[model samples]
Target chain A: MSFFKVEHLTMKFGGLMAVSDLSLTAKEGDLIGLIGPNGAGKTTVFNMITGRLLPTEGKIYFRGKDITGTQSHIINAGGIARTFQNIRLFNDLTVLENVMIGYHGRLRSSFWEAIFRLPRYKSEEKKMRSMAGELLAEVQLDNVADEKAGTLAYGQQRKLEIARALATNPRLLLLDEPVAGMNPRETGDMMDFINSIREAYGLAIILIEHDMRFVMGLCEHLIVLDHGVTIATGLPVEIQNNPQVIEAYLGEPEGA
Target chain B: MSERHRREWIYKLCTYGAIVGLFAFFLQVQNQADEYQIRILNVSAVFVTLAVSYNLINGVAGQFSLGPNAFMAVGAYTTALLTLSPAEKELSFIIEPIIWPLSVLHLPFLPSLLIGGAFAALLGFIMAFPVFRVRGDYLAIVTLGFGEVIRVVANNVQSITNGPLGLKGLSEYTNLWWSWGVAVFTVFCVTRLVKSSFGRAMQAIREDEVAAAAMGINVFRHKMLAFVVHAFFAGMAGGLMAHLITTISPTLFSFFLTFNLLVIIVIGGLGSMTGSIIAAIIITHAGEWLRAVEEPMAIGPFNIPGIPGMRMVVFSIMLILVMIFARQGLMGRREFSWKWFCGFLKIGKRRG
Candidate 1:
C-alpha cells in the first residue's frame, strides 16, 4: 500500500474537464513535481486534493484512509496541507499570529475555556505561542515576528506562507507554484529551503511549478500534464527526454 | 517572578481595579443623578453592548451582515413577552388574545433576558446557513431583507407581538447596574474571545477564507460562532433597551437601528474592540448633544426657526467629515492595550 495515493481522480466543471483520470502515488518521503503549461489544470489538481473542490470521480487515500470529498479543514486536520500560487497571509495580523492560526485546528481547549481564561486554556495558549515563535525563528522571521505580515518583503512573505503551512504539522505538503515570481537567486534559495524542510519534517511533497529549472533540478520524479491528461511520468531525466512530453511543450513542430 | 511576568501581574491588578472603580462610579451616578441623566447613561451602556458584539461579526469576523436589528427585535419581544405579567398581557393584547404559552409564561427579569438572548441566537443560527451562502453586497442586502421580514412578521403577528402598538409601560428593570454590568461583561467576553486562538481563526477567515480553510481552520464554523455570539449579545442589549424605555414596538427595531450601529462601528474603527466602545459612547451622547442644532437659535440679530429632523442632517455632515479625514475611523484597527497605555503616559516602552 502506498503512503499517499490519488486513484483515477477526475474533476469536471460543467462540460469542461479540468482534470481526468489523474492517478499518482507517493512514498513516505518522496519528492514529486507536477509540471504543465499555463491553464493545464495544475491548480485544479491541488484544489481537488485539498478539498477546495470535490472531484467528480476519484479515490484519495492517505495513510490507509479514504479522504475523498471531505471538507477542506477536515482534510487539512487529517494531515494534508497546501500553499497557494498567490500568497495568502493574514496580512493584517502579526507574523506570529498568522503562524499561531495554523495550530488552531489542534487546539485542545474549548472557546469557553478561552473566554474564561481557565488553566488549560492558559497552558495551551502558552504552548502555542512558544511553538509559533519557534516556527518564526526557523523561517528567519523571528526578528519581525511582531510586525504585520503585509509589511514583509516578497521572499519573506513566501517563506511565511510555507511556515504557516508547516504549522499544521502535515505529513503531505502541496506547493502550488512555490517560486512563481522570483529572481534566480531567490528561486535558488527557495529550492534549498524547500529541500531542507522536506528532509527536516520528513514530508512527502507534491509541488506544481512552471519554472523548468527548479522542477528538473529539485524533483526526483516528474509528471507532465497537457489539457487535463498526464502525457508522461518518469524520473526527471527520462521525462525531460520523452518525445510525448516534448510534443506537449513544443506543439508538434508546426508542420510535421 | 521575571520582569515581564511582574508587569503582566500589575496589568491584571490594574484592570480589576478599574472595573471596581467603574462600578462604584455607576452606583454614585445612580444615587445622585436625575432620571434623564440616568436614562442617557443606560442608553450608552446598552449601545456599548450592541456595538461590541456587532463588531465580533462585522469588524472581527469581517462579514457584512445587517440583520442585527431583526435579532434585537426577536430578543426584545421575547423578553417583553416572557417578563410581562399574565394580567398585564391581558390588558395589553386588546386586538387579539396573547398566545397560549407566552400569556401564561411569566418569568423574572434575569431568566427572561437569558431566554430572549438564547432565542435570538437560535434565530441567528438558522439565518447563518442561508445568509453565509452569499457574500459582500449580496450578504448586506439579504440581511437587510431579513430585518424587514422580522419586522413585518412582528407587525402582523398580533397574538405574539401585540401588533404595532407594541408592549408598553413594563416595569423598569434595566437600571444603571444591570445595563453597565452587562456592557462590561460583553466587553470582557468579546475582548477575551478576540485574543484567543478562535479569534485568530476568525481573523484569518476575514483575511482570506480559502487560505484559512487550507490551514485547517473551519471557516463556516468560525463564522457561525461569530454570528451566534453577536446575535446573543445584540439580543441582550435589545432586552436592556426594552426595559430601559419600558416600551417596544416593531418600529423600534427597524433599518434605522441597524444603520445607527453601522455608523458606530465604522466611526469606531472596524476591528478594534476599544474603538467600538469609545465610538458607541461618543455616538450615543452625540445624538443628544447634536439635537441643539435642531432647536431654533437667535444668533446676533438673526432668529432661525427650529426645524425637526435637523439634528440628523448635522449628524450626517459630521459623519461625512470623519469619513473624509479619518477613513479608518478613530482607532484604525488598533486596540487600547496596557503597553500602549503605559507608552502613552511616557512610563514604559511603546508596544501594541
Candidate 2:
C-alpha cells in the first residue's frame, strides 16, 4: 500500500477552483517534488494534504486510512508534519521552545499534571526537552537554542523550522518552499540537510518548490502542475523532456 | 523517588513556607493596621487575582476577551445566592418572592467560593464556542456584548438576585487572610501553569494561532482552557470582593470594572505574571491615593477646591504616558525570579 495518497483532490473558493482533481501518491522513503509556476496551486495542494483546507472533492488517505477534513492537529498526530512556505517560528519563544511545541502532540501529561508539576509531567518534559535539544543539534541550531527565534538569521530560521517539524516524529514530512529565501550556498546546504534528514528519519517527503533546477535535483519523483491541473508526473528525467511540461512553462512554441 | 522529584518536593515545601509566612504577616496587619489600611490591602489582593487571571486570557492566550466582568457577575451572584441565609434571601427579595432551591440552601464561605468559580468556568466554557469563532476587534465586541447581557440579566432576576436594588447587609466573611491567601494561591497556580508546557502552548497560540495549530496544539481546546481557568479565578476574586464589601449589584460588574482590569494588565506586561502582580498592587493603591485629588484640600491657609472626577483624568493621562514611553509595561515579557533578584542586587554571579 502507498504510504500516502491524495485522490482526485479539489478545492474551490466560490466559483474559482483553487485545486482541481489533483491525484498523487508516495511510498515509504520516496522523495516527491510538487513544482509549478507562481499561482499554480502548489500550496493549495499542500494545504489540503495537511488538513488546513477541506478539499471540495476527493480523499486524502494516510496508510490506507481516510483523513479527509480532519483537524490540522489531529492530522499532524497521525504521523504527518509540515513547514510553512513563509517561516512561522514562534518568534517570541526561544529556538528550543519553538521546537518543543512540535513535541506537544506526543506529550502524555495532562493539564492538571502540568499545573501541579506531577512526576509524570516532569519526566515527560525532561524527555521532550532533551529530544528537542538533540533535534536542534541535528539541524545545527543548538548554539542558538536559547535565543529568540525572531533574532535568528534567515537560513538559521529555516533550519529551526525543519528541526521543529522533525520533533513531531512524522512518517511523512512536507516542506513548503524550504529554501524560499537563501543564497546559492545556503540553498545547497539546505538541499543536503533535507536529503540527510530524509535518509536519517527514513520517511516519505513531498516538497513544493518553484526553483525547477533545485527541485529536479532533489526530488526522485516529479509532479508538475499548472493552473490547478497536473500536466505531468514521472521520474525527474522523464519530466525534464515532456512536451506538455515545456509548453506549460514556455507558452506553446510561440507560433504552433 | 528520583533526585528530580526530591528537588521538586523541596521547592514545594519552600513555597508553602513562604505562603504561611505571608499569611502570618497579613494576620498581623489585620490586628494592628487601621480599618482603612486593612480594607485597602484586601481590595488590592482581590484586584491582584482579577488582573492576573485577566492576563491569562487576554495577554498570554491572546484571546482579547472583554467578558471577564460577566464571569465575575456569575461568580458574585453564585456566591451571594449560596451564602445568603434563607431569611436574608426572603428579606432581600421583597420586590419578588425568593426563587426555589436557591432560597432554601446556604453554604459556608469556602464551598460557596468554589461553586461560584465553577459556575463562572462553566459560563466561560459555554461562551468559548461562539467567542473563539471571531478574532481581534470582533472578539472584543462579542465579549463586551456578553458582559452587557449578563448585567441586563442580573437587573431583571429580582427573585434570585434582588434586582437592581442588589444584595446588601451580607456577612463580611472575606478578611485579610481569606483574600490574600487566595491571591497567593492564584499567583502560585498561574506561575506554575505558564511555566509548564500548557503555558507554552498558550504563548504559542498568542504568537500565532495558525502556526500553533499546525504544530499540533489543539487551538480551540487550549484557548478554552486558558479562558476557563482565568474565569474561575476571576469568579473567585469577584466572590471575595463581594463578601469584603458586604454587597453587590448589577452595576458593580460593569464594563468599567473590566476596564480597570485592562488597565492593570496594560500597566503590567501582558505576558508577565510577576508584572501583573506588582502592577495590580500599585494600581490598586494608586486608585485610592488619587482619591485625595478628588477632594478639596487646604494647603497652609489657602484652600484649593477639588475637581470631582479629576482622578480619572490623571489616570488616563498616566496610562497614555506609559503607553507612549514604556509600552511593554513594567516587565515586558520578562519574569521575576529569586536568581534574577540576586543578580540585580549584585549579590551573586549571573546565571541562566
Candidate 3:
C-alpha cells in the first residue's frame, strides 16, 4: 500500500487556480519528482502536500488516514517534512538550533516538564542535541554547526535545510530546488547524500527541481505541470521523450 | 570531556552562582542604602525585568506588542485589592469588582506578586488572541488601544480604582532583593529560553514565520506564550512599582510608561535581550545622573544657573545622539557570552 496518497487535489488562490485537479501517490521507498517550468505552480503543489496551503478539492491520505485540511503541525507529526525553494531557515540562530526545531514536534516533554527540568525532559533535550549533531554530520555540515545559519555559504544553507527536514524523522520528504545554487561538484555530492539517505532511512521523497539532469536520475516517477495543470505523468524516461513535457518546457532543447 | 560538556557546566555554574550572589549582595545592602536610592534601584530593576521580557516577545519572537502598561495596570490593581489595608479594603467595596470577592484577601508581598502576575498573564493571553492577528503597525495600534482601554476602564471604575484619586497609602515594602531577584530570574529565564529549541523556534518565527510554521514551530502558539510570558514579567514589575510609589494612579501606568519601556528595548536593539537589559541600566542611570546636570553648568569662574527642565532637554538630545551614532544600542541583538566577553582579551580567548 502507498504510504501517502493525494487524490484529485485542487487549489485556488482568489480567482486563480494554483494546483488544478492533480492526483499522485508516494508509496513506500518510492522516489517521485514533480517538475515544471517557472510559474508552473510546482511549489504550490509542495505547499499543499505539506499542509502549508489547503487544497480546495482533494483528499490527502497518510498511512491510510484522511489528512486533508489537517494543520501543518498535525501533518508534520504524521511524518511529512519539506524544504523551501528559497532556503528558508532561522537565520539568527546557530546551525545546530535550526535542526533542533525539527526535532521539537516529536518531543515527549510537557511544557511544565521542560520548564522544571524533569529528569525525562533533561534526557530528551540531551538526546535531541546529539540527534541534531548527528543530522548535521549526516549532511556533512558538522563544522559550521556553531555558526549563525545565515553566515554559511548558500550551498551549506541548502544542506542545512535538508538536514532540518531529515531531523523531523519524516517518512515522506519534499525537497524544493535542493541544488538550485550549488556548484557542479557540490550538486553531485548532494545527490549522493540524498540517495544514500533515502536508502538508509527508507524514506519516500517528492523532489521538485529545476535541474533536469539530477531530477531525471534521482526520481523514479515524474509528474509534469504546465500553468497549474498536470500535462504529463510517467517515469523519467517516458517524460524525457514526451511531446507535452517538451512543449511545457517551452519546446525540447535542440541537442536533446 | 567533550567541549560542549565543559561549556555547559561552566554556563550552569555561572548562572546559578550569579543568581545566589545577586540576592546575597542585595540583602547586605538592605539597611545600608538610602531609602530613595533603594527605591530608584528597585524601580530600575522592575523595568529591567519588563524590558527583558518584552525582548522575548518582540525581539526574539518578532511580535510587536505595546500592551505592557495595560498588563502592569492589571497587576497593580489586582495587588492593590488583594493586599489592601483595612481602610483600603473598606474603600475597595465602594469600587466593586466585575465578580464578587470571595473575601477581602490580604496577601503578603510575594503571593500578591505571583497572583498579580498570573492575573495579568491571563489578560495578556486574551489580548494576544487578537493582537497577534495583526502585525507591524497594526499590532502596535491594537496593543495601544488595549493599554488605553485598560486605563479607561480603571478610570471609570470609581469603586475599585477610586476613580481619579487612585489607590493611596499601599504598604510600600518593595526592596532591592525582591526587585533584582525577579530581574535576575527574568534574564536567566529568557537567556535559557533563547538557548533552547523553543527559543530557536521563536527566532525562526522572527526570521521567517511562514517557513517556521512549515517546520512545525507552531508560530501562533509560540507567539502567544512569548506574549504571556512578557506580560507576566510586566505584571511583576508593576507590583514592585505600585509598592515603591505607595500610591496607585491610572496616570502611573500610562502610555508614558509604555514608551519608556519601548525606548529602552528599541535603543538597546530590536532583537537583543542582553541589549535590552544593558540599555535599561543605562537609561536608569542616565535619568539619575541627569539630575546632576539639571542645574546650570558651572564652568571655570562662570556660575551656571540651574535649569529646571534642562535635564530632560539634555537627555532628549542624548537619545537623538544614540539613535544617530549607535542605532543598534549597546549590544545589537547579540548576547554577552563568555566568548564575547573574553573576545576583548584576544590572547586569553585564543589560549582557552
Where does candidate 3 stray beyond 4 Å? A251-256, B2-24, B91-103, B296-316, B338-352
TM-score of chain A of each: 0.98, 0.98, 0.95
A1-256, model 3: which lDDT tens digit per residue?
5678889989899999888989998789899999999888899888887777878998889999898877887788788899998888888888999899888877777655665577887898999999999888877899999999999999888889988888888898999999997878888988998999999899999999988999997889999998899999998999998998888777766788
Backbone clashes in candidate 1 total 0
Model 2 per-residue lDDT tens digits across residues B68-177: 89999999899988999998888888889987999899999999999999999999999999999999899999999999999999999788788899999879999998
Show pairs that collide, candidate 2.
none
Better of 1 and 3 by TM-score: 1
lDDT of 3 at B20: 81
Q: Give the TM-score of candidate 3.
A: 0.92
Best by DockQ: 1
Clashes of each: 0, 0, 5
lDDT computed for candidate 2: 0.90
Angstrom error at residue B155, model 3: 1.2
Ranking by TM-score: 1, 2, 3
Native contact fraction (fnat) of model 3? 0.59
Native interface contact recovery, all models = 0.91, 0.78, 0.59
lDDT per residue as tens, model 3, B57-127: 88888888888999999988888777775555575545564334624557788898989899999998888
User: What DockQ was computed for model 3?
Assistant: 0.53
Cα misplacement distance, residue B225 of candidate 1 (Å): 0.7
Q: Candidate 1 on A1-256: residue-level lDDT in tens?
A: 7789999999899999889899999999999999988878889999988998989999999999998889999999999999989899999999999999999999989889999999999999999999999988987999999999999999999999999999999999999999999999999999999999998999999999999999999999998888899888999999989989888887887768
